[model samples]
Target: MKTPVVALLTDFGTRDWYVGSIRGVILVRCPRAQLLDITHEVPPQDVVAGAFTLAGAAPWFPRGTVFVAVVDPGVGSDRSLLAARADGRYFVGPDNGLLALALANAKRYAAVRLTNRR
Candidate 1:
């Protein structure tokens, strides 16, 4: 059984509590989750950069790894959250095409636009 990894890619730099706060929440929920930082230095509000960063690195992780990506400008907007499974890995992020390239390259893919938020 492969280890469960949670890879994070965000535009939020390490100047504030954003990245650390998120990591705390994830650890609370998934204590055993291996956290990997794809990059927290993505250009601010650059979804294309996030997309490229994630797509480029995702294939290197073991299957079943979960990717949690948050790019800028649409963090708390009404934009739908996405849960995507591609090439045996899972991705959770905004629906701003950050997962586009990876999903396109996947032999098996499925994506859901989250509608229910409570």
Candidate 2:
């Protein structure tokens, strides 16, 4: 397969290193992975805004883009991480009801909860 390109969408701004940290992790995991940031100011804790931003920008990326949506309020908690492969793209984030509404437009290929991973 070709090198994967990951698009990052987060509420964390550029002033901080949170976004950088995520990028670093991806770099280490997939040395050839390409990283792209959709936006950092996602109206903090606003799932609706993040959903809107994701929907609008996602269609523009090339097929197989790994989209990381992180407008997570309950991240790393009871909230389950979700990976949705739609049309030819992959999405990772919390299953906090933000995607179900917007995913109506894309073709859902697969969906699984992170909790199921052992």
Candidate 3:
């Protein structure tokens, strides 16, 4: 079995515990999963920057990489979260254009609103 690569991109600066806590949770669930930080300096809540950065970095990663982007300004609102597959990579993030650029040029892509909290 191959270890899964989970790439994280967020505006959560390293000065806080947010990034570390996210890593901890991922590690706890998938002990062998490899975590890579695409970036954590996305100019807080700037979804456009996040989208651009993610799209730029995404193509360089190997296929099967899963990206988690967290640059949503509408965090606690009724905004929907999305789980998307573009080309062969996966993306999970708020449906606020953060994942749009990355998925735009994909030859094959699909997305679903993540409504089930379980």
Candidates in order, TM-scores: namely 0.94, 0.91, 0.96
Candidate 1, residues 1-118, lDDT tens digits: the string is 4558999999999999999999999998888888999999999999998899998999999988999999958678899998999988999988888889889988989999989975
lDDT of each: 0.91, 0.84, 0.94
Which regions in candidate 3 have their CA more than 4 angstroms from the true location? Answer: none
Question: C-alpha displacement of 78 in model 3, angstroms?
Answer: 2.9
**Whole-model lDDT for model 1 versus the true structure?**
0.91
lDDT of 2 at 42: 92
Tens digit of per-residue lDDT, candidate 2, span 13-93: 899889999999899989999899999999888998998889888889999899988887886677778888887877888
Alpha-carbon deviation at 66 in model 3, angstroms: 0.7
List runs of model 1 lying over 4 Å from the truth: 1-3
Give the range of the ten consecutive residues with the poorest summed lDDT in model 1.
Answer: 1-10
**Considering summed lDDT, which 10 consecutive residues are worst modelled in model 2?**
98-107
Candidate 2 deviant stretches above 4 angstroms: 116-118
The ten-residue window of minimal lDDT in model 3 covers: 72-81
Cα misplacement distance, residue 14 of candidate 1 (Å):
0.8
lDDT of 3 by residue, 1-118 (tens): 7899999999998998999999999999999999999999999899999999999999898899999999998887888899999989999999899999999968889999999765
Instruction: Give the candidate number with the greatest TM-score.
Output: 3
